[model samples]
Target: MTNMALSGHTFPSATLTCPNCQTTITYYDVSGSSYYGCPNCHAFFKYENEGPPEILTTFQPSTATPVLPIGSEGYLNGQFVRVVGLLHKKEAGSFYRWLEYMLLRQDGRYSQLAEYNGHWMVIEPTDHTYSHYHVGGKTYTINTDEGQYWLYNQYKPELLNAVGEFDWNCLEDEKLTISEYIRPPSMLISEQGATDSKWYKARYISRSELATAFGIAKDVLPAPSGVGAIEPADPDDRSGTLLAFTGMLLVAVFVLQVILSIVKPSTQLLKESYQTESDSSGTIKPIITSSFDVDGPTVLAFNLSASLDNQWIELPVTLINEQSGRVYEFSKTLEYYYGVEGGESWSEGSRDDDAVLSRIPSGRYHVNIYPARDLGKPVSFSIGITQNTMLGSNIALLLLLFSIYPISLFVNKQWHESQRWSNSDYSKVYTEEDKS
Candidate 1:
């Protein structure tokens, strides 16, 4: 290939007349381009170093137009480039087809724009290489210097139609073997032939990017459908930020909970003992406690303790606000049963229980206690009330609430990844065992 530096409004050119179609064809790179495919009749011609060009073969003219037409100039990948060539390729054994647009810069560098199923990739030649190994009917490649890239596809592609110019005889009989390796938005491709080989690095590109860079209308670019091989799993740029935000929120809630627990310890409001005698008619009047003052909105803990000998008691309590006449009702059953069975001492229940009430406003409150116990025993229990008790469950609930977006982002990423590898031979989500 020639390395002549071109400037603004300067373009290399050569003109020739096609023998098959008698149509005049123009060449953009004089020293580099030796093959010309007639755009009108779809006939390919090869030009030697010092002779008249020879006819290679011909293909039926296609009705579909290239997205980036030949000779289109644009700023791409930080370079002013011209679309010098376009080749329509088909898989050797399949009906699948794609387009490859050759781009030439002023610095004599070449880049390729590959389009498949409306997805675009910017590919550039590279000097990197990798070693490959085959196992279980799959091919894998390892690049010791640049890390691992999984093999995606290996196939032979035939040139179905060609237009504009190329550096080599693209229609030559020597077959080419192409392999693709992918690592999500990045790809490494190897093109091996009988006498030469080439390596290319490709990164995914969006339709809007190309349209903006080339000053083309966005509607001219096809809309993408299924996930591309090298397409990013998550399109949202804020996924990482969201994940970090969730993690920081969890930490902040935990730290705040700990600080509040230390600085604002629980304050006992009331602690009193009540005695009840067993009554078969259940006519015992309830004991009412004195009014306790609650300063502001807070959480209240009601604690109960009792001494029993193989007996149980059900304590039903009602808290009434003196100012508003509002009532809160709850119940707890305290039991302590012990026995010697099989020469082992065993206990089944505890004699203490507690209940929590939240969001109580500033007011004076009193408790009405209703006690129900075993018919043959009398029970004595002490009741205690504490205010401003820090609850860990609140922090847990906050963490769960804050995790919704991050978890949904993760699920969306996995779903996109699964879609990307759905048609791949070496799928990461589905193994051979799963298929069986």
Candidate 2:
């Protein structure tokens, strides 16, 4: 293969007559030596060292028309380029077929535009050589051999059709070995053959972007199917951000709760004793406590202590606002029992119970207590009321409610990750035991 700089040329186009079909063809050779295929006869020819053209084999004409046709001019990578040639190639052992458009700048620089299943990628030859690459801070090994197990497969792509002019002798059924390393939606491709080894950096291109670059309509391009090797990672995925936000909200709520518990001093409103006799019927006389002023949103807790032997006591209490007649009702139950079972003494229930009312408004309030006793037993109980008491259950419920958003975001992120890795050769669900 001849490598010549095609820049600084002063030729329009070279006219040649094909020796086989006698078809007259006009071709451009900015690279000093180039290949040309007859548009009508589809005969391949090569010219080297600016000499006369030599006839190669004739290939079949392609039925497929490219979105960017040969001889079409466009601006790519800040340079005006013309689509000079097109090669439709397919994998040797697979049904995978792709199109490669050869782009030639006026200054003789060459690049390739590849399309596979409506996915577009632009590959430019790079002067940099490397056995490994650091992409996004992660190191990836490069595979050079044609046959071995690797992260990516080695392909011997056979040329199916050719049109227009190419720098190299583009022939049909000619197979070239290529090795690729991919970090989607970017890839590094190494072309190795009898000629010099070539490296290229490939980046994914969206249909819209390709259309705009080539001055074509977006609908004219085919829609992409499966995920492409160089398809970009979605930047709009904000799962990590949402999880962080939820985590911070949880921490803030916990810190606020702790600060409120330490800073706000609870005020004892009422502490009184009430008794219910065994003969008491229906409803006992309500014990009214002295009125206390509640100045802010506060928690009103009532602690009831009772003495009962193997019996239960129920108390219904109401806190009534004197100014607005607003009423808050709560219930507490007390029971204690002791017995010997299996030669072990055990006690069940407790002699004390408590109830809490949260976020009560500011006002003057008094308590009314009604007591009920079981089995005609007398019960003596004391009631204690305090404001601004912390409710642990309420805090726990709030935390649980706030966690729903993060949990949902996490599940969605996991699903997206699974989709991204579905094409990988290595999977998380596979294990050595399962393989065995």
Candidate 3:
């Protein structure tokens, strides 16, 4: 009896018996090349255009079962296909190994799926040469001859195991020469040799998509490790996005500050000069200033200048909102000290002091200044008040708060970049130190 699988298209089938084990196997000549392996005894065979099957050698059956078993069917690239063969290959001098599943459509077309470290890639043969290829609107140049020189032990790929039917004469000892060029999440591979030359386009696929396509549970798949040649950058990487958000927030803060400064203009409300006599008591009479109208929440800035040589002056002033009887008090200390240290004269404090009172409500306000002198001498000082002054401390504090996001984003980006270049030859963190 001839067993067959049907897809969207149909093909003529053939049956042969393995000479070594006498096991009956049924398959299709999708590529016209007669090469097959026994599913029961794992014996390799080859057939001519019209001849009996010749047994080459028996190979060891792989202990591991494929996620997509033989005879399993699926629809891919608008065509129905069935898994026909599986080849386990490994690079020489390295532990890197991959599985290639040979897929055949009922219409006699072939496709390949390569998997490495849990990463999947769908590869299809293309007539175009590897010299130039276009993907995602970008043209890439690949040189198979020159690339193989730098790649170590790349051509010697050991065929670990295989099953099912195949188109070419599959051999375990044959070394495959391969050249590859990667453009993150996608790659172009060129297989060239003395007998045949072929180019293939490889695209990365998620494990979830592969599991769903193969009708398998996601948990059965292995977790991916390291960076894949065609693995895409993480979409959830928020470094750039967070940096952009921080920039916008900073701009908004600057614009808000500018608008606030424009809307609430700082104007000189009062300027007066007063003198304190030493003959009077330590507490001088309060100097009453002219009242001014505040239209909104405002900042009152008081600046005092006094001529003092190695002396300090403490002036306490109180602002009274006459309409609501709200009193806002502030103090300013002006000191100018000069002395000779190590035969050099230096001055420490300035003779001017500034004090600011913020969030003063809308009302008529008056300033009452009480002056006191440390020495028994009279001192003259000038007083000035400005409304709606900008607070430097507040702006500085807000700027610091807004900078955290950008700093964090920069750090994360640097970390990711380091991870990307960890496998490179010219890495930032070198193994040896440079003495020169």
Candidate 4:
């Protein structure tokens, strides 16, 4: 069956495949470029007998195929590519899990993967190459040529090979250097060499082998000069420092919020309160007063009537904080107070008084009261807000939250994305920046 998992605007089967094994071949698309491999024989190929391929479509298994075995070279992801790579950590955990992936691109750019938690989990590569291989009964894949090289070279057996120096049960057995055990010859260069004018060099060896060939150990490999200050390579120290700094920052923010909340000024109980005046004669009108310096409206009330025979005839309600503006549903409230008498103080309970102005901001206000029996004489009363209870506490809490998480994520994401590391000496196939 055709692989439904395969996807791209340019299909792989539509590109090139090995005639012998029929496995799809991938390549770097360009004039006069070529690659080598045979899936059936499980053999590596070379471009020795054939000159650089001149076109993507014209290079067939017969014309481009040599005894050295490069069958077909197809393009991937709009760039000419045939390989993939990744960096893995050997972690010690419950049942063993490889938790991270660091991928390299054609331009030596690096990208990391979605984190993982598992044992013997073989994840296939994404984009370009179908390089999933079996390692310890699980499938592993390299998505790019550089990734392929990095794994097959730096840590060869871990990525795609099930037998890494030893079988699963015999993991502790000694293994010999790959070059000492494997032969070095290409089919393209026969006993009777091909008459083709061009021949490709065979440098297909593990990176460690290549290092051995070049007499350069990894330790001896010079760090590229002038990139930046080179710190002594102690991995644990860097991580510890970062975590400590983050914890300290969080503690500091929490302490500051507590201090700010404590320092917020307390409001004094309403002073210059509860003064009243009653009018002369059989009816009564009481005017009450209070002092405040709030920025919004305040209200004060007085009892004038309870029964229909002595109900409030009318009342003057004015919002007098000139600096503040408002529109009120005073009619709804007036209907409740009208024609009602002195049974409960019109300002009888504090809950009733607070309810009237709970939603209002700090300010000054006045209301006039007249007994229903005496509709002509409504007496005015002054009201003022003592304090704004919501503003200060809410503001401090908001600042504390912003200091911790969402704000931190925004800053950290930008910092990570902006970070660009150079790997020019490390790889050639992955030439693009690791935008992942």
lDDT of each: 0.81, 0.73, 0.71, 0.29
Question: Which candidate's lDDT is highest?
Answer: 1
**What is candidate 2's local distance difference test score?**
0.73
Best by TM-score: 1
What TM-score does each of the candidates earn?
Answer: 0.83, 0.67, 0.66, 0.24
Clashes of each: 0, 2, 1, 38
lDDT, candidate 4, equals 0.29
lDDT of 4 by residue, 1-436 (tens): 1122332322232134444455665432222223333333333333322343221111122211111112112222233222221222222222222322222223433222212221111122323312233232111223332333121111112221110000011111112111100011110111111231221112122223323432445444222232111111221344456556667766776686577446643343243323223457745654333433453332322222222222233333333443454533231122223233567444321111222333455555433333222353333322333433444444577656645654565565444323212311122123335222
Per-residue lDDT for 1-436 in model 3, tens only? 2344543343555566777787877666534647777778888888766577788878887665678876677667676777878888777776778888888875677888888777788888877774543221222344454341111112467776767788787683354677666654566776767677777777788787777777778888777877655666553556667767878887888898899879877788888888875435555666788888876677878888998878888888899999889998988888888999999989998889888888888888888888876875667789898888778888788878977766776775556556544543222222334222
TM-score of 4: 0.24
Error in Å for residue 67 of model 2: 0.9
How accurate locally is residue 106 in candidate 1, as Cα lDDT from 0 to 100? 68
Please write out the lDDT profile of model 1 over residues 268-365, one tens digit for every residue: 99999988853477766588998999866889999999888899988999999999999989999999999999999999999999899999898999
Which sections of candidate 3 miss by over 4 Å?
A: 1-5, 8-33, 48-50, 75-80, 105-108, 130-155, 172-174, 194-197, 236-291, 297-322, 325-360, 366-414, 424-436
Candidate 2: residue pairs that collide: 185-230, 185-231
RMSD of 4: 20.7
Q: What lDDT tens digits, residue by residue, belong to model 2 across residues 1-436? A: 2233322222245555665677665455544537776667777787667577787777788766688876677777787777777888888878788999988766677888999888899999988664743222122355444322123445788777776787776652354677777655567787776766778888888888788888899999989887666565454446667767778888898898789878887788888887884335555556677888886688988888998899998888898999999999988888899999999999999999888888889999888877777766578889888888778787788877977766776676566456645655433333455344
Q: Could you tell which candidate, 2 or 3, scores higher by TM-score?
A: 2
Q: List all candidate RMSDs to the true structure.
A: 4.4, 7.0, 6.8, 20.7
